[model samples]
Target: MSLTQEQKDAFKAIFIETVTNFAQQVGQATEKVFLQILPLTVVAGTEYLKSYEEDLKTKLEDCKTKSQKIIGALSTVKEPEKVEKTGDKHLPLGELLGKRVQRGEDWKWDDQDGGIGSFGKVVGVKGNGWVKVQWESSRNENRYRWGVDKAYDVKVVEIVDDLGDIPPLEEQIKKPTSWVIGKSVVRGRDWKWKDQDGGEGQIGEVIDVCDEGWVEVKWKNGTVCQYRWGGENAFDLKVVPKPKE
Candidate 1:
């Protein structure tokens, strides 16, 4: 009699559990045997376990061959699509939108270089091969063209999957409005300044609040510096309750 869908699912679960337990038991037994065999091989000399070793090696090879065949029959996995590292020729313009990118070695314009390791986000796509990018370091917008000297100069570092949650390029860099003195604040979730001052979760007092979105904070670890909190920069701080005075 053919099994119902529910019965089939129950059987599959039981089969998986049984196989998992069997694998664990086999692994434990094999480990114990290996431990015993190691001492025996050392104390009794290599020749003592030579015959059994050869037999085990033959069995292992047989198991590997059978496993390969089983895997080939069951698995429909194909080799992953290889990306060419030679140039950005493989990168399409459609894939680059809302992506954070860095300049590659092939970038020729020395005067327009956005520092060595600075990264930027693609905000707009221009005609020809040019793309508009909002740079993190400069907090300025710049346009870069692709396929310079046969190879594209842009190297994508990150892709912003959900564009709906993010604001426009112009809105992101504008000066923040909300800033008051003596407020307790912590670094935002997307805070990138891990090496500078105290890292994430380090609470500090907002010593000086600026209209330009930068706030001067005195960290608990005696670090006093200005950081971007809101507006044109990434929201770098979140207000927390004042400590029990």
Candidate 2:
């Protein structure tokens, strides 16, 4: 977005005011001691003026930088439709689609087949609080619903801004397999660190197996994550016999 003429004028006035006030203050200070230190004062005042000019230049540059940042932020402001409030929900399509999100606080992590801390991208909107999400660990798109109350609703999907150490989308969309739930698996000896779900050589139970080649594993350490198996030569895991109690 381009700045309005009024805004440009306002900024120019501010810069002029700042420079004029600073010059006036410096002139007044120098005037008070002008006669007392005439000879040597000229050289010292020249050096001091040079330093002051440099400092003022830096401050002006900083102000310009801050102004540009403000303009950039204003340019990114969502349109009316993007912030349209639907009851308690304030997010619009501009904020949700293509955004990274995590399961909400009220998600049924334990009761459901999925694990906690899963992340996904909002790929489509079905309106009325429903959205299609392409989960980070699977290629299939799942439907997620938003709650009426965004602050304390069970259906809220938390937006994730920083991805941190999450695996890339390229590695997450592995081909599907025919693995069954309840099967036990361990990291194969040939498994590399790059194929990690819950660390190398860790034993885990198959909590859920989707047709999209995504196998959700609950590790001995209680951490759960999805991994690739079966198709596309994804041989990172080896099925192991369940240990008897």
Each prediction's RMSD over C-alphas, in Å, is 20.0, 17.6
Best by lDDT: 1
lDDT on C-alpha atoms for all candidate structures: 0.61, 0.55
Model 1 over residues 6-125: C-alpha lDDT tens digits?
A: 999998887556656755777765455556555764877767688789999999999999999999965754323334566443465545655677886567656354688887666555
Task: For candidate 1, report its TM-score.
Answer: 0.31
Error of 2 at 215 (Å): 0.9
Off by over 4 Å in 1: 1-89, 111-113, 161-245
Q: Which ten residues in a row have the lowest lDDT in candidate 1?
A: 172-181
TM-score of each: 0.31, 0.27
lDDT tens digits, residue span 34-138, model 2: 444456558888999999999999999999999999999867753333334454234653245445566665454342313566666655554455555666665
Which ten-residue region of model 2 has the weakest summed lDDT? 147-156
User: Cα deviation in Å at residue 244, candidate 1?
Assistant: 48
Total backbone collisions for each predicted model:
3, 2
